[model samples]
Target: MLLQTAPAPGAWERLLAVLKEWDFAVFLKINTVWTGAFGDFLMPILRDQRTWYPLYAFLFIYVIYKFRWKALPFIIIAGLTVVLTDQVSSTFFKNYFGRVRPCNEEALRGMARLLLDRCPSSGSFTSSHAVNHFGLATFIYITLKPYFGKWGLLFFFWAAFICYAQVYVGVHYPGDVSCGAVLGVLLGGFTAWIFKKYFNFGNRKRGDLTTASPTV
Candidate 1:
């Protein structure tokens, strides 16, 4: 006969208590109150990666033209950062945690302001959008900060805006994006550090690694 083991006392209750206190209030406000033409126009665009291809193409061209061959390692770092964030957020966090998305929550069915035409059929504990955007932003900024100064940091705000749109569009909760942000920042820093120290990516001086020449 197998030995009987007792369940941990208040485990479920403790988890519920944390979730209850984590400000689902702000989530409801952002999802419901932020609706309008700007959201109508921007949220769907934010949700679709294809919509940003032109921007992506331009960014790569600018980086390559500005930094030449030396920028290749940094580009690889950014690509890996995004891929890692996307995979970790979806496969590990979303699948393992299996939290219900706001649009799919039974309690929020009528109330959650879903802007997208169709809701995703996946869990939303940690948003892949937030992870990928923030991760890419952080790693790229880290690599390019010396080269572009404060201007390089703008990518972070862009990532933040993208994450905000997720909450407004009702695809994710604030807590989910928050977790994703933390994860992204960590992973981004980690990747940047690896590239710098182990991969012979060179020193903090932009001139030492990549050219400071202005593009035409």
Candidate 2:
């Protein structure tokens, strides 16, 4: 007789099972409630690093004043890279994949009770918030690493917080956040590198190049 193996669970079924597990359920409930109560409120605030961009711009301007006019072009290039990469990832990849939000699926409907409210019927799989925030964080951290030294780790935490907030709010899956983070890091780093090589932007000491830290 031929040996038979058990079939693998479908993606949706696996997601449901993961959601049903005790630890994950607890996290899901806590995150759902916390994010639900404030998810929308916080989303507008944290969605883009745009709010923080002005502050960074001011800082970079100050750096230019302290350093040299050459820094202006670098700052402008870094800022534009962050903005463009973030917009492309959020607008194109997130929508193109067009995965359904976790709470919107019938397979996971029972887990909905743990959610603060129904998940939005928008595209999922990759979180815009995660992509934008992480992308910005990665770009900024890489740009400033030469100056901040170990302080760069803080940006990783900042990105992680933003990405986790997505899952907590029931808008994305762990997998979605994970993939978004990876994409964000790659895009952010690539953008930064391109500007550094072509435009000679930011602090581009040859040794300063580094990979983006993981989030989620």
Task: Using TM-score, give the best candidate's number.
Answer: 1
Q: What tens-digit string does per-residue lDDT give for candidate 2 at 5-32? A: 9998999998867754643455466455
Per-residue lDDT, model 2, residue 204, is: 41
Off by over 4 Å in 1: 1-18, 199-216
C-alpha local distance difference test of each model: 0.79, 0.64
**Model 2: runs farther than 4 Å from truth?**
1-64, 113-121, 201-216
Model 1 residue 24 lDDT? 70
Which stretch of 10 consecutive residues in model 1 shows the poorest summed lDDT? 207-216
Model 1, residue 97: C-alpha shift (Å): 0.5
TM-score of candidate 2 to 2 decimals: 0.63
As a whole number from 0 to 100, the lDDT of residue 146 in candidate 2 is 66
